[model samples]
Target: MEAEDGKLKCNCPSGTFGEDCSLGVCEIENPCLNGGTCVPASNIADTPSCICPPGTFQPVCEQCYYNFTRDAYIQLDSQVMLAINSLNQTQCDEECDKDERCTFNFIGLDGCYIFEKPVIFASGNGDLNKYKERCMQMEECLLLTHILEDNKCFLFNVTLNNALSILRLIEGQHGNNIAEKICC
Candidate 1:
């Protein structure tokens, strides 16, 4: 074939296309894996190279092969617990869910960790209803403490002591009165 300006025109070979008939079209026979795109090689006619993204590795760039899994750590104030075991996020969650004692949680590049929440249940209280009630009450107390501390109360340090004293006094005065004073 010839162009209007008399330049020679050539059809791209099967599975190839471009101005110079130099780019190879990706086909089932030459599939790209790991989500890579076919890019034309600098000097290779009708041939292309697969470009894979980070964290993914494969010959054709069709299947994603992650080099790393999710990491997790427990953050308590200034303390940071390092990764327990290397695993993906789903595995981390599964491990945490399998443990009943675990509470709050977060995921990171290393894995996942169970945040240390204060245990509200006293010894021997394994009943679900009792546990729920205790957790709710403890949450309220913690919230009150946080509020008082935020307000910069000078006696905030003694709040627990004061509460204990009040409970003792109520118990001494009347057994029924103690039950009434506690939040339902």
Candidate 2:
């Protein structure tokens, strides 16, 4: 724009607003979604960003990392279970490598339990409700798989590499059921 004094005037840039363009741009063209909060950029040269709500992520908060149901049992593939004793960590790892179905293992004080579950093991115990309660108290616990016959509960922390596996576990079918944590 041309000012009355013949000087050039211009509008605020992409991520700036207000009279002097000092305010960060957010409300004008908010990029956030799924209830995410828009955080304007510090400088006019930079673009605004979004702060995703719980259970959601990505630049626009369009993706979700948590399941919608809490403590809900999910069916998984027919997994082969093995119970062994006195196996060290290296031996347990070797055992898991031997079988394509063996995805993870739980090493207890007394023995090791191997299964084809997808999520990584954080901790496990014979008491189902006890570990389930402990998983609730933990901030990183995203999924829990329980073996009904053995009365074992295993806690898992979800990550990008394992999120798809966890989702597949939800869609699988078998006798055993896994519990997924719901963030939203």
Candidate 3:
């Protein structure tokens, strides 16, 4: 907190500034929630406001997001993923191990949600939860399924640019190799 011109000011997050910080950064023409920072973008392809802080997940950051497992690996925030946050990190880990469908685990918030398979769009709210869990047996780029999905969930060393091109080739285009190619 800080004071300016004899007025009290709270240390607000990105995209917000005011007395108590109660007012939404984009409350007027735009809006952001769950502590998701708002960034004004001139590009039409981008959104007016959407950051979805660690605890919160969603383009709008309205849901609590957490996920904790093991082996802590690198993950890109921009990629579409299913994430959730929970106050109980242990619960997150337990869920990951107990679920037989789990294909991969991600660490975030306090609890992590495991996927039966490498996954897609999933988010939770940070505003309502706190992260407190950890991962125990996470594998780094252990599975090649991420590459097949083209879901933008691969490690830096696992660039599949050429692989995609090869697999995407139409039948009879790449000859023998094309016939054996697999895609998901």
Best by TM-score: 2
Which candidate order results from sorting by TM-score in descending order? 2, 1, 3
Task: List the candidate 3 regions with Cα displacement exceeding 4 Å.
Answer: 1-81, 119-184
TM-score pick, better of 1 and 2 = 2
Which residue pairs does candidate 2 place in steric collision? Answer: none
Q: What is candidate 2's lDDT per residue for 1-184, written digit by digit as tens?
A: 4474776565766666665666665766777888889886666557778888765654666643333333334433334346789998888888888878776776777677676644445344456566656666566667776655555555667633364554444433343445566543
How would you encode candidate 3's per-residue C-alpha lDDT over 71-159 as one tens digit per residue?
Answer: 22223332323356763557666766776654456565545655543322123422111111111012122122221112223221122
The alpha-carbon deviation from the true structure for residue 125 of candidate 1, after best TM-score superposition, in angstroms, is: 35
Residue 99 displacement (Å), model 3: 1.9
Return the lDDT, model 1, position 48.
64
Q: TM-score per candidate, in order? A: 0.23, 0.38, 0.22
Instruction: Report the poorest 10 consecutive residues by lDDT, candidate 2.
Output: 64-73
Candidate 1, RMSD to the unseen true structure: 22.5
Native-referenced Cα lDDT, model 2: 0.60
> What's the candidate order when arranged by decreasing lDDT?
2, 3, 1
